[model samples]
Target: MTSTAGYDVERIRSQFPILQRELKGKPLVYFDNAATSQKPQVVIDALVEYYSMYNANIHRGIHTLAEEATAAYEATREAVRAFIGAPSTEEIIFTRGTTEGINLVAYSWGRANILEGDEIIISSLEHHSNIVPWQMLAAEKGAVLKVIPINAHGEILLEEYYKLLNPRTKLVSVVHASNSLGVINPVKVIIDAAHAVGAVVMIDGAQSTVHLDINVQELDCDFFAFSGHKLYAPTGVGALYGKRELLEAMPPFHGGGEMIKEVRFDGTTYNDLPYKFEAGTPNIADTVAMKAALEFINGIGKENIRRHENDLLQYGTEQLRQIPGIQIKGDVAEKVSVISFVAEGIHPQDLGVLLDQQGIAVRTGSHCTMPLMQCLNITGTTRASFAAYNTKEEIDRLVAGLHKAIKILR
Candidate 1:
């Protein structure tokens, strides 16, 4: 399944078995990719292969199954390092998901480095996962949380961000791409600016990793987190990439097996770089499956996938704008294949329900960005997000479904 100069979208779609299923006698139109992507057959097969063939714990056992399982699991760390262009596998730490990854940094790094009167900065377009963990950390440490405002276009105010950075600013954690608006944030610029102010930056890459090319070293961000589920792998598996120095300095996020090299009643010494944070047995099956997902993305080349998805975004945006009452949110010039919009006189939930009945799936409501919803001066928007496997024909179906919903509601 190698990606070529000419993208074979139909061939690509054929690889995902779930895409073939019909919903209510109609072909499924999955436009809710921002929430989570459907897995390819290869990824599914990897999961089944792991359980059927190995089915053992990793890192501790000397037996054949354990050795194979450990090797496969560690192979994912290397795959992730290459996928994101991190310097070393030691920098990659597996966690439950983006939410858990963020929480780990907040608990480990935040608690260690932040002091009273220190400030952590984030943007207005952040998902609640990025917001709440920091809020909890700030409250606990007596540190202040500041937000960089966005324009109506859903972009972070660069000047405001600069003004917010100061000696007191200790961390700047922002999303690589907004889940709600689909705006691809200028994370490199954000990272550089934060570095100028001596602040460590953590990028929430859950959305961007699926649609954009990521190079951690190029961006020079101190930390990066993304979910495997969003990248077409199984749920409960994700990775956090942190600078080796920072990861080494931070305390262990969890206390349990594999995190300890030595333990006694009086004292305990933690394990090395990644395993210190990755406690317990871990999600072995899904972690192994993540390598397959990354391989799938690699086989189809990130640039090829990006180009196809960009076409979907452009075409979908143009077609949706033709509707009389449609108002698109986050009309940023630089964005991924995501469109959040509201139809006049129709609630987002109502529109979503109607679209679902027609076998078009879309995410509705605040999309876990309630603060962003408030910033947009709306309760919610119906979001149609695309993936490499999605087609313009599916976007057309989504547009038709929207019209049907409008006709019924209005």
Candidate 2:
């Protein structure tokens, strides 16, 4: 396993209370980080503090609790803005998760801009969240959906992607990284090419935001969406980063109490910038706690986290490759800490079950990217995703468990 000097992994692991638990007479080895990361005690304590101290609705109340709640909630918006290097807090609109963020854009921006003959482009590596919303938008608007092809290595075919761009290309929405394959795409190039065709680009940052350093301005993407849970934050909370001009131009995604300026029986005017997209009362407690998650990452440093995860990816890849019947998918040069594989004559679901019996948590399915599975000519894969707290010792346990699984099943 790779090592970075001065990185204390054990110290980091201690922060997560759930990691101390055991299952089925074995220590829990969590490898399902891609599904959802384990929350640290600090994040949990933040949630508790919010509920116990100042539990109130935000933006509408004038009391002390309301002011505190609103401040904490809005503070997260600024944190997210800095996290992704967005220009302003006004550009950050909070949503349920990555799925809702994409849907908001499709419903609001897609409906307002896309014409009958326009073409919307996406890659074969997108999650269903990124793909389905655009598909609905395209069908509703009579716009054509174009897909960029991928190589056998699971990297996007950049040459083929350029050929799909033309004047009729209205939008290009692609994932910054593949959730199933862990392949990091060249989004800046994709964005630049789409801009050349006068098309707006939206990046599904559900996978990338936690791993990579993202700057929306540098990437020049029109929209960027990511889930908070992927970055060690609470579920049901995410943020969408849209260009100021684009967010201002797009209509409100939902109509409700807070997203209003002057509501009359004749007509109602919408609120400015981010508030226009965030309708009604939001998940205030979770939103406030999300700031603590970001702080947790910042305290550890993203570089150190990346180094540790990459070490796990490398060590796991080597160990898994030694198994005779195992076939690893998506062997790309650049990837996150995810490994998807399948064994000969064994079903992934069955393997997942056996692994769980050994207290090894993994995900086994199409991973919400059925098209990618179909493209790769597989049913599904057993995925082991790593996080910062994961260690080489855990990978050793996983390898041993896989050997046991092979011996029993094969």
Candidate 3:
């Protein structure tokens, strides 16, 4: 409960108005952060201010409101560029979410580059967003989709991954962190290996962008994708970061209004880099507020937040290990503040429902990583993930809830 290094968890908790609400009769304990984060008052204020003051469409109008709205929206692009260490704002393309970002690459870049019999490598740790788009692309292009295997600890086997690569390998797409298991993959190494085989790499940063320090240029990944909702912003906005050369070579994602330079009946000339991919009216309010969310994270300081969350992870893991018949999925040392575990006799769905009754919210089922669940030889696991505002006290409540659930279920 003490504020160390200027990080006051209680102060942070007060900023989130929803954290004060009760789910049942008890106080709320929201641990479903991997699914989506709760927004602070600052981010909420940004949305309200945008809609209340300057609610105009971006890029087209030179009027006062439009200028204010457009500047705010584009400020988010610069924030994302600095957040991920992208070379320029031109490489940062806005989308609906991480799913749309990957789909954008698969549709635009993958369509142009991939050939029949060419290979794409993904890992066992990927979320469905990373897997499905490539599956669709592979199906359409007659390309081979290969999966890099994982060990018993749910860590990627670098040796096995190397075996999957060849001159025929076209792209290597993977999740930087596993949403289900909470295992952080060695992506920098994966990127280098794929490049050795003359392949481009795309990282699914849906989970990593919030927890880990991401520098896409240092990682040398061709593309990176993440969502805004997961980063404590609104639901409808996210971003895709690609290399400048790769983005220029790839065709425009969608065709319409702002995405085009000139619209003639004979043919259309598309706009440059980012606008070319951003078709139609964008999620202006949420995208504008996303800048506030980024600044929120920066204000608290990521390393400072990571330390507190890591402490919570250690404490939670220690407490949960005492519960009988409980086995943690991906019981590895390398992970963010996420814990996924299966009980011997009880179903995960039952456990989650029991926790919810106590107002301790957690994610149940496969977490969109069904293939990972199948690989782990379980139906699903109950997931309790943490964020900056979470506390050791909440983990205690979760542990107590789990103890009660197991007693009743067994």
Candidate 4:
């Protein structure tokens, strides 16, 4: 696909090998970006180079290969620090993904601080990862789990959220962007409000990191979590950013070799700040390759990508709105390149199958936000999320595919 626009959409698309392939004898149209992004050539090359040349353990190795591997792995941590505008690398800890990051904070910090009769507040716009861990933590700690309600527009009602916050509010966790509806919550206001009540907040950036600019310092969130795969890197690797004081105060998430200072029968001394939480060897190769993914995004500049994707989002939403019996979900101005809708007479899974037959990829389901689905009065939605490399042509194809699919379904 090509574009006659200010941005080089073709050049960006060329860097992704998967964009050139054919699915069902048709050019692939990838619009499932919120689920996970397609990696560029640089990222794939980094992975091969790491595994082929320097496949060694990190942080504890002295050999040449091990030193090289460890440097590459740690480089990604620095890159993540820069990507999120974090204060220091000491505050960043690598994890299996955003899910692990949330669980880490919940188990470590939640257990340490939360007391009986405390309240943990989450929003209606959270992914299952952000919701389940806190629910479990609140239950275990004899703390109450409360949800911030949303309006009919699929947005977190700030007024209602304020009403929920009290002196007893311990932790407030929320998604930076709604995965199912694509609404960007008013997190800054939410964070500041939570702080007013002496509550620490966690922002789940799984769906926002790639599409939006993130600054943990500017956001003033106590903890921030994001998945690497959502940002064009490989799966099974993500980062959690915590304030230094909070991380130091909280206990370690796991007990293992790397996370230990000295292990003895008497007592085990944990390692320093970040490493204390990172237990095992981790997904070393993927973590190393994650730097390449960040570099790729940095080269193009996030502002340019955002503008291009915003254009695509506008075009896609306009084209879809014209189609009959298609009701777009979360019809709001403040959002990224995500469009979720449900057809009047068609099931989301069936619509997805038909679109897949046309080589058009879209996510169809509750999108791991069952509570949000229930709140929105929808069983599921057909979500088409865009990335940096996507174009108006692909969205046109999506519209055409939807028209054909809807006709048959009706």
Candidate 5:
């Protein structure tokens, strides 16, 4: 359970107050990071300060308070643009979360570009957010939704994906990292192949943004989306990064106050770039906090944090493998810090309940990936995900709790 030296795991743990509390008189072990990471103090403080000090609607402001609030909100857009390595701030659009971001693209871009008899490519491992959006859009547009098959290990079959690409393929959206199984897909290659056919690619980065270094420009992806809560920020805030030319071509997602350039009885023109997509009064406090979360990651250095988490994942995988009768899912070389497994003769829900009794938190059930669970012919799995604040000792505690839970269930 010893952490690697040079990284102060103890000091890092102190930043999160929830980690300090005990569950059922035992030290709480949180491993449901894929669901939502616990926010750091800096992000929390930014939220409090924004509400306490400057709370006003952004854009079209004249007074000092409105100007300060507008600057803060716009600064978050710049931070998001930098965070994803987007080409311009105009390409960054704030949304409720990844779900809304995908839907925005589905409704706007999908409806505009995809016509009848066209195909939309997606993988079998996609979460419902990724799958359902395209499905709904395809049904609306009369376009066929084609699924890229995955192998037994839950990794996408790239050869099959390449074959699926044709002139009829209009859009390709895939998860950068699987939430249910921790598999990291070859997004760069996927994007490249999709672009070869002139089809636009959108990466659902809900899980990968926190664990991996994202360079949207380098990735050459048409669209990228991620949630703030999963990246140590508050909920109800997320961003969608699109290419400038593509964003300009698509229509606005929601029409309201700031999104419009001028309003008349005849018609109205939308605002430029991002504001056109961000309609109504936005999530001011959470948007400000998201910038702080990005700054916190930069302060710690994403590469160093990723290295530590990878080590934890390796250690956890090895330790979990030693436990008898444990069926590990998605044990592939290319993966993030997600592990899903099922104990023989034990239901996943039962295992989660037993682990929680020992102050350990793990996710059970389909994890919003019913199709992925069905692909593996299992009802669900017990998922344990890692984050920057996680330590080696936490993994040890998790393994110990899993063993005890298995024994109790048996």
Candidate 6:
């Protein structure tokens, strides 16, 4: 509710109830934060409060419950608008998650604007969600899909990206950070380069929103999408931030109750910016609960969280580098709190199973970026992603688990 001037880590950790839970007689070491963060009691409580006290459909109802529910729902929008530093609340559109958000952009903007012989640009580090929707759109629109290749360290080649951008480029959809490699792209630079050639840019902020400071106005990105679940909120709720002019220009993604101004047998008129994108009933409780999650992060300070998690990344990277046969994936210096690695003679699945037996939860697989793995010449990597709640002690446990697993596997 206020500026995150003085962050308190311990106080913040105390708010998350799952952090206090034990798994198989040991405290849960939740290093799989990149997948979905554990929700705080405050966010959980918000869900309870909404369902228990004010349960009603919002916007159109006039009953007392509807009024209260509407206020709570609208508050979450304001919270999201403030969280991303959006120009206006109208610019923030609710979606299921990043996947749905990207799809919305593709269907609405890409389908409408993209033409034959036009090009759509994305990087090699994109999640399948980012890649598939654009490819589908490009195919449907008869537009060409151009990929900005990543170097050995998994960082996008800026020169290659710039060279790919020209008058033919209609849209540039890039991830703000890689979910698998943990590489944070120079999105502002990318956006500027795309704009120089008159292409609209959409940034998939699913990974970046949690750790980095975001000022959408400052970045001047045309569209920004992120999932609430990745940012310590409930799943099934996320937001899409678009510049007002662009959102106003684009057609509605879906046709339904809340998104319409009027419905006639022959034709229908759409509502304003955000409501036009959010069709039908939304994830009401989870959407309302997201404000509490954003408040929790705001209380802790995103910059402070970034500092702590970056420290964890550095510590985990160095410790894993010392292990025999262990190789870190994507040695990009600019990264978030995610560390993905592989061990010689050990499958990532086996490593994950062994780590879980020791109460160290980690993710191992393609991690929703199968193409990225193919590019890296690997099937998958065992990924341990950190949050503000994670600590050096947890990193030590991870390292210990890896050492024991390595000895047995070898």
Q: Rate the local accuracy (lDDT) of all candidates.
A: 0.93, 0.93, 0.93, 0.93, 0.92, 0.90
lDDT of 3 by residue, 350-395 (tens): 9999999999999999999998888878889999999999988998
Better of 2 and 5 by lDDT: 2
lDDT per residue as tens, model 5, 62-116: 8887899989888999999888898889889999899999999999988899999
Clash count for each candidate, listed in order shown: 0, 0, 0, 0, 0, 0
> What TM-score would every model get versus the actual structure?
0.98, 0.99, 0.99, 0.99, 0.99, 0.97
The TM-score measured for candidate 3 stands at: 0.99
lDDT of 4 by residue, 1-410 (tens): 55536788888889999999999999999999999999999999999999899999988888999999989988899999999999999999999999999999999999999999999999988899998999899889899999999998898889999999999999999999998888999899999999999999999999889888899999999999999999999999999999999999999989887999999999999999789998988899999999999999999999989988888888889999999899999989999899999999789999999999999999999999999889988899999999998988889899999989988888
Error of 2 at 272 (Å): 0.8
Give the TM-score (vs. native) of candidate 4: 0.99
Cα error, candidate 3, residue 170 (Å): 0.3
lDDT of 6: 0.90
lDDT digits (tens) for residues 1-410 of candidate 2: 33557888888889999999998999899999999999998999999999999999999899999999999999999999999999999999999889999999999999999989899999999999989998999999999999999987789999999999999999999999889989999999999999998999999999888988889999999999999998899999999999999989999999998899989999999999889888899998888889999999999999889988888899899999999999989977799989999899999998999999999999999999999998998999999999989988989999999999888997
TM-score of 6: 0.97
List of clashing residue pairs for candidate 2: none
User: Candidate 4's error at 182, in angstroms?
Assistant: 1.1
Better of 2 and 6 by TM-score: 2
Q: Write the per-residue lDDT of candidate 1 for residues 58-141, one digit (tens) a residue.
A: 999999999999999999999999999999999999999999989999999999999999999999999999999999999999
- Model 6 worst lDDT run, 10 consecutive residues: 1-10
Taking every candidate in turn, the Cα RMSD to the unseen true structure, in Å, is: 1.7, 1.1, 0.9, 1.0, 0.9, 2.7
What is candidate 4's CA lDDT for residue 326? 93
Candidate 4 at residue 200, lDDT? 99
Clashes of 1: 0
